[model samples]
Target chain A: MSVHVAPLKTYIYVFLALMFFTVLTVGVAFVNFAHHAPKGIGNVLNDAVAMSIALTKAVLVVAFFMHVKGSTKITPVVIWGTLIFMVILFVFTGADYLTRPMTTFVPVMSQ
Target chain B: MSENSTLAHHFDSYAQQKESASLGMWVFISQEIMFFGGLFLAYTIYRWRFPEAFAYSSNELDIGLGLFNTIVLIGSSLTMALAVRNAALGEKNGTVRNLILTMLLGSVFLVVKGFEYAHKWQHHLIPGPNFQFSGPDPVHAQLFFVLYFSMTGLHALHMIVGLGILAWLTAQAAKGRFTPENHNYVEGVGLYWHFVDIIWIFLFPLLYLFGRHHLT
Candidate 1:
């Protein structure tokens, strides 16, 4: 197999992009979308935005820096499989927690 | 069948050996993702349960330090990538220089983290019998600190280990151990370094920037 040595320019470009996203995330954090949106939705939106940017950065690093973009077929398979399981873990656990009655487990300190 | 000295007898060619090494590293990284995933899950649940407490506690974190460290870590990732590039091109000095620079940035991150932890310690936020918080929901706020310390503490530990790897890589590169055809070790370590950076990419926002908008 021929080694695919990525150009230096590619690494620099990805680095710049990661830095830009980092600043954008910090900027987004200071904006209170809650004041503009319905009661609970604002915080959710904030989290969504922050996480989306983080995901973008992660993708950039994984693809270019980690060379997964040019890697063998099994690499993405392993990554996506792990990610799917992670989602399952989150969704099933979240289902239980989010649906539970608030009073079911009150903080002992509050009592 | 392989002519390259670095090629293992068990592998058919250098390429096959390199692919196997890369695959093994990814598998290890997959397990690491799950390991950290559990903490992220706990964080999400607790933050959902105690939004205000978590926000207030998050606000107590110094964003300046967090942002600085984010840049530092990302910068280290860039240097690590460059180190791999140089190693792949069989540039010995370039590889060593970039690896050393990566280690330097990583150490700076740890130093900043040390100061942050010291700040927490001084402010009585270490989350123990002596822990104290003036917030309305000190209990829940303490929970936030518990996650904060554990998550970032674990990340710091990874950085220390990464630095150790970089040190060894630097020494090896200095000795001209890696060549264009046999730099899989450099590439593998670079992947680990970038993975750690990705973890911090998520950690910075979740831990330091969570409730900044609420801080009036």
Candidate 2:
């Protein structure tokens, strides 16, 4: 019932990859997309790129460093379940605010 | 049973015990994800509502410290993974050495983070009465700092807890409690340490690096 331990070299590679991604993210943050895109679009592009990179790094950490890659079947299911729940939580809550009428708000309480 | 006293009687084999432990840890981690998810959602809401202010406020953060601490955390994760690997190899000294190294690296991260917090205090970045954000919308800037402190503070709390676990594991390693066949505890700790590192991975981009382009 012992888990399959990753080879020591695998751990090293994963660490190096993580470090590389970290530097990459920081480096990419310096790029000025404002030069090529409109202000709002540029900010979105910047955020999208940075976020995509961060998500990739996160996957590396979870799958390799955390040994989720070769873990039991149930482990991945639990992991996916958590991820799905998070997506639902963020999307639903975010959509509510994102789609709201900018002018609509409850009146402030009377002093 | 099987000359390994660590094996619980309920488990049919060492593998069963390890599997059970792994499953339990994953479940716990899932719950932790939800706990932090709420915080992330709050951050998303505020960021959506006040993007410019959030970006401006983020620029005030010490990117140098943030980057350095990011590396420190990644290095700690490596050391943590090594500790578990050493345990799986049944090398008691190796496990102890790596665990100590991991703890030291985690401490370094916290120390740097402490300095960053103090710097924020001196700069009046705290989100209370003394808050002083010099950007266009100081009010919304306060929102940024609120999320920043809350998220990173929670993360630091996890690091402290992880350090405590590493200390305990270090003691166990010194006692020769971990062998290649019975090192689930070490693996469990590795999962936790790596998870903490993952949180920082997202935090680095979301909080520290988000508005850096404007500054440059």
Candidate 3:
């Protein structure tokens, strides 16, 4: 098998993009849309936005910096497999917490 | 048919040897994901249980320093990528240069993290009996710091290991041991370094930016 070398420019581009996304994540955090929408939904939207940008940056690093885009056939299988299991773990565990009934853990001392 | 001495005896070709080594590294990384995944799961459970406290606790962290470290790690990943690129192209000096830069950036990250940790210590944010927070639920806030220290501490350990690998790679590059035809060692380390960076990519937002909307 032959080696596929990524050009220098690609790495530079990815570096810049990652930096941009990093700043973008911070920038998004300071912007609040809670006044326009329901408070709970707005907060969730903000968290989702931040995480989505992070996911994009992770993909760029994996595909380009780590050479996953040009990697051997078996490599992506491992990458995808790891990702699937991670999702399963988080999703399964999150289901219990997200579905749990709300309870007041602190009892009022004066009530 | 081992053209390269680095090639193992059981391998049929240099390419096969390289491929297997790369795969082994990825498998190891996958295991690492599971390792860190457990911590993330714990974080999620606690955040779900005490969202308000988690949000307030996250705001107590210094975003400026967190952002700075993110850039530093990203810069290191770029240098690591360049090191691999130069190694694969048989550019000896370029490989050495990038390897040194990567190591420097990695060290800078650790130093900044050390200072951050020290700040936490001074403020008694170490999440124990003396822990202090002005947040509504100090117990839940302490839980946030517990996750914070464990996750970032684990990530820092990986950076240290990565620095050691880069140091070894720098020495090897200085010796002109890698060539366009045989630089799987460099490539393998590149994968490890990038995987570390990816962990921080997720970590930066989760640890620092997750509930930051409360700041505004």
Candidate 4:
């Protein structure tokens, strides 16, 4: 089978995009998303934005730099399966943690 | 079947062999994702539990250096991609040059990380008996540092391993061991390198960029 060698320009373009996203994530960090929204909601928004940019960068590296875009069909299947499991790991664990009641115990000395 | 000396007898053609290799590499990478995924899940849960402590501890980290290393790692990924391309094109010298460049960037990242770790050490933030945090919640803050060191430490270990592979690839590349149709090793290493970079891509934001707006 003939290998599909990506053009030199494609790597350059993807590199530039990754760099741009890196800077954008940093810049977004300094912004007070909380001030624009309710106190708690603002913090959530900040984290959401930061994670979104990171996910974008990860996708770019996986697709172009790692050549997943040009790889065999089975490759994506493996990746997606891994991702599904990861989601389960996070969601189920997070659900348990978020639902647990906060209880503090105080020990008393006998008189 | 193709009579290519590099082609394994179990494969019918070079293409099938290459596909199998790529699939194997992806499978390995998927397991790696799960390995790191556990740590990420722990991080998410703890950060959710102690947002203030996590943010406070995160603020203590040097974002400037973190950002610099992020760029350096991404730059290395580019060189690694170029190296794979060169190897696939049967350009031995180009492959070696790009691989060496990638190693240089990877080393720079490690050096910066070493400095960061040392800084944390000197500041009494290594999360041990001597660990100290001036924040309101020192215990929770220490938990953040625990996750910080573990996650980034694992990532650094991966970088060191990737560098070792690149060094070997460079030696082989210099000896003209790779050709256009027989560069599966180079491509596999490239995927590993890029996977490491992707881990850092998520790690930088989660660890260093947490609650920066509060500091501002």
Best candidate, DockQ-wise? Answer: 1
Best by lDDT: 1
Off by over 4 Å in 1: A38-40, A101-111, B1-4
Between candidates 1 and 3, name the one with more favorable lDDT. 1
lDDT of 1 at B49: 88
Interface-residue RMSD per candidate? 2.2, 3.6, 3.5, 4.1
> Which rank order by lDDT, best down to worst?
1, 4, 3, 2
Candidate 3 share of real interface contacts: 0.85
TM-scores, all models, native as reference: 0.95, 0.93, 0.93, 0.95
lDDT of 2 by residue, A1-111 (tens): 444668888888888888898899899899877778876687688789888988998898888877778777999899999999999999898888878755422212211
lDDT of each: 0.91, 0.87, 0.88, 0.90
* lDDT measured at residue A36 in model 3 versus the true structure, 0 to 100: 61
lDDT of 1 by residue, A1-111 (tens): 456799999999999999999999999899988888988687688899999999999999999999999888999999999999999999999999889765433444455
Kindly report which residue stretches of model 3 are placed more than 4 angstroms away from their true locations once superposed.
Answer: A38-40, A99-111, B1-6
Judge candidate 4 at residue A53 and give its lDDT: 94
Residue B98 of model 1, lDDT score: 97
How would you encode candidate 3's per-residue C-alpha lDDT over B1-216 as one tens digit per residue?
546566667988888888888899999999999999999899878787889999998888899999999999999999889988999888999999999999999999999999999999999888777888887988778888989999999999999999998898899999999988789889999989998998999889888987777767
DockQ of each: 0.66, 0.57, 0.58, 0.58
**CA RMSD per model (angstroms):** 2.0, 2.8, 3.0, 3.1
Q: Candidate 1 residues B50-143, lDDT tens each? A: 8889999999999999999999999999999999999988899999999999999999999999999999999999886777889778878988
Give model 4's DockQ, 2 decimals. 0.58
